[model samples]
Target: MSKILVTGANGQLGQCIKELSVSLDPDNTYLFKSSKDLDITNYQQVLAAFTLENFDFCINCAAYTNVDKAESDTQNAVNVNSTGAQNLATACNQTNTTLLHISTDFVFDGTKNSPYIETDKTAALSVYGNTKNVGETEIIKKAPKSYIIRTSWLYSEYGHNFMKTMIRFGSEKDSLSVINDQTGTPTYAKDLAEVLIKIIQNKPIPYGIYHYSNEGTATWFDFAKAIFEITKSTIQLHPIATEAYPLPAKRPKYSVLNSSKIKTALQLEIPAWRDSLKKAINALP
Candidate 1:
């Protein structure tokens, strides 16, 4: 049995890992720790956790996820997203454990007007994006036997994500304005978590960055509309340009990531964006 340690047990992706672990294998060797138990940013804490657990693999799901809020709090974002990841990578290196890290599509600037390939150059548009890039770099530089999977537009039943926000607003408001300028793929955290598990179980994960999300592209407006449609909510979604609705942070206009690398490399089947959305919505309360 491979001893596995999962960081960020409280977050969406981490919680999904925990939930999936229950059915995947009750006897599976795994330890789930929330940040309150082991703050990844602290090198001593990370080292102590790894020394105690001596895990064969470490799946890092903790992150600073506030997009707009990251603009005002850049240091905290960098600390958690970048430095915390670095600490984990260092600990993984010292512990001789494989790392499976989660990353965002925001690492790219979305200037290509197309789905970004793994080989494509990355240019972050927002503070969150920049710091995530730093974290990705940290993993690449520090961990040799690591799998960095970059996904976008993630939402899950447990977290405060786009789908949950839309659901609440749809029930409360008659109409909502969503930006149409930016485009990306909607990745269900559950789906992502399963993919990570499969990668760990099936093959020796090659050390590099790979992109995966549910197939298809849609703007925020399209995503919000899909949410309302699936929920049978009567919220009118008004599509507007990004300029018309500014936020504290500047997101990429088109940050869709290409998953052909993962599909062909891992021989994995990717679910459609709408199909995953339907499942997520149905699973919701």
Candidate 2:
């Protein structure tokens, strides 16, 4: 029985993992820790935790996710995303633990017209993206046994996310305008949680960078519309270009990831974005 350590246990993805862990292999023991319990930025704390638990695998779900706020809080973002990642990787390497790190599609500049593959050159456009890219690089350099999985537009029933935001806004507002130009897949956090567990359970672990998101593509407008449709809300929705709505951080125009590598490696079929959205909505209280 392998011991699994999950960081950022209170976050959406980590919470999803905890929820689904009941159905996981009974032989495996899981330890879920939030930032309060284990601060990844402090190398000593990370090393101590690993030393105490003797974990076989560490799933890093901790990240600085505020895309817009990262513009002003660059230092905090870099500290958590880059330095924290390096600390965890170093700890994992020292303890001989395989690290499964979560990454973002924002690492790309979104200039490509085609779906992004794992090998594509990264040119992050936002502070959050740049920091996350640095985190990925740090993990790759520090931890030899690491699986860096980049996902896009993550949302779940738990925590603050786009789906929950839209649901709340749709209920309160008579009408709303959403950006239709930015395109990517909405990855359900529960779906991602399950896949992460499967990777550890499966043999001949594929230790490398890979992409994982619910299949298919949609803009923020399409995503919001789908949410309203699923809830049977009559909120008026308008589609607008990226320029219609501006934020501190610049989002990718097209960040759809090609998940073929992960699918083939795991021999699994991913659920469609719409299907997963429905599941997430139904799961909500």
Candidate 3:
């Protein structure tokens, strides 16, 4: 039985993995660790933890996800995303553990009109994006057996996310204005967790960068509208350009990822964004 270690256990994707762990391969032993349990930025601590467990695989879900906060809090972002990733990669290499690191779609500047492939040139526009890009680079350089999966617009039942925020606002506010210009696919953390586990269980797949998100593209406005529709809320939803509702961090204009590579490699059928959204909404309390 392969022993697995999961970082950022309290986060959305990690929580989803926790919830689904029981249903996964019973032979595999799973260990979930939060930032309190294991600080990935501290190299010695990370090395000690890996030494103790002798983990076969480490799924890194920990990240500084706040786009706007990253602008002002640049140091913390670098510490967690870049340095932390470097620590994990180093530890994983020493322990001979395969690392499965999560990344973001923000690595790209979103200038391309078509869906982004794995080999596309990256030019991150925000501090969060830049740090995540650095993390990916560090992992590639440090770990020989590593997989960097770049996902977009991740949401789940466990944490603070776009879906939950929209649901709350739909109930509280009479009307809402969401960004229509920015387009990307919303990824369900549960689906992503399943895929991550699948990659671990079904070995011998190409290990490098891969894009994974729910099928189909939608703007933030479309996503909010769909949330209200699924929840049977009558809140007035307005579509506005990014200029009307400015954010501290500049978002990608179009960050839709082309997931054809992962699908072909894994022989997996990814669910549509709307379908997964409905499932997520139904699962919500």
Candidate 4:
């Protein structure tokens, strides 16, 4: 039997991979590792993991996703995002294994009004974005055959995401403020997990950059409202502009991605946003 390795096995996306794997292969062997078992920042450890597993492929789910924190802790973010990605890319190249690297919409400055194409010029807005972009360049240059899928607004049952946060705050309070100026497509980890598995199994050399998210766009306020409605909570949402919702790191106001190329090229039928949302919400608890 073949094996697939996944890093960040404890994160939201990693958990989704585990759940999706169980359904895809009842007895499939998964070499899931957290930062403890193997830290990508350490080259020798990554090499050792590659040698020990000798798996056919790897899906890198680990990332420094703390946007604001990353602004101050740029070194930490670069260490993991850039250097670590370099380690993984180099290891994959040497081991003759494929890699599926996860990316974010933050690679763009979010200035465009229309959905961002995969080939759009990348202009990072924050330290987190810059580091992630560096990681992407390293991986692409080292492992040309790897698949780099850029997603946005990720959420799941296990992690503290926007949806979960809103649900918790909404149930406990009567009102809240969300940045309505920031618009993006909400991506469910479960859906991305499925897509990853398919790409790995098929191994078609359509290998390049791709954008994937749910089929629709919404602001943080809209997303929060959706969560409240689903959970049956009456949390009044105050629409706030991005200026009013300042943070240490600047976020893209509009980062809606164009996933049509991936869909057509991969022959994928993406699930509707609401349908995926309901499944993710129901999976909680």
Tens-place lDDT per residue, model 3, 1-285, is: 889999999999999999888798677899999999999989999999999988999999999999999999999999999999999999999999999999999999999999999999999999999999999999999998999999999999989999999999989999988999999999999999999989988856988999999999999999999999999999998999999997899989999999999999899999999999999998997
Give all TM-scores, in the order shown.
Answer: 0.98, 0.99, 0.99, 0.97
lDDT (Cα atoms) of all candidates against the true structure: 0.90, 0.94, 0.94, 0.89
Give the higher-TM-score candidate: 2 or 4.
2
Deviation in Å, model 4, residue 249 alpha carbon: 0.7
Worst 10 residues of 4 by lDDT: 198-207
The true-versus-predicted C-alpha distance at residue 175 of model 4, in Å, is: 0.7
Q: If candidate 1 were superposed on the true structure by all CA atoms, what would the RMSD be?
A: 1.0
RMSD of each: 1.0, 0.7, 0.6, 1.2
Residues 1-285, model 4: lDDT tens digits? 668899988889999899888888655578899989889899999999999877777899989889999999989999999999999999999998888999999999999999999999999999999999999999999997698999999999987798888878977998999889899989899999988887766547487899999899999888887888788888787999989867999999899999998898778999877778888889889
Residues 1-285 of candidate 2 have per-residue lDDT tens digits of 899999999999999999997787567899999999999988889999999888999999999999999999999999999999999999999999999999999999999988999999999999999999999999999999999999999999999999999999988999999999999999999999999989988895568999999999999999999999999999999999988888999988999999999999999899999999999999999
TM-score of model 3 (CA atoms): 0.99
Model 2, residue pairs in steric clash: none
Model 4: colliding residue pairs: none
Worst 10 residues of 1 by lDDT: 198-207
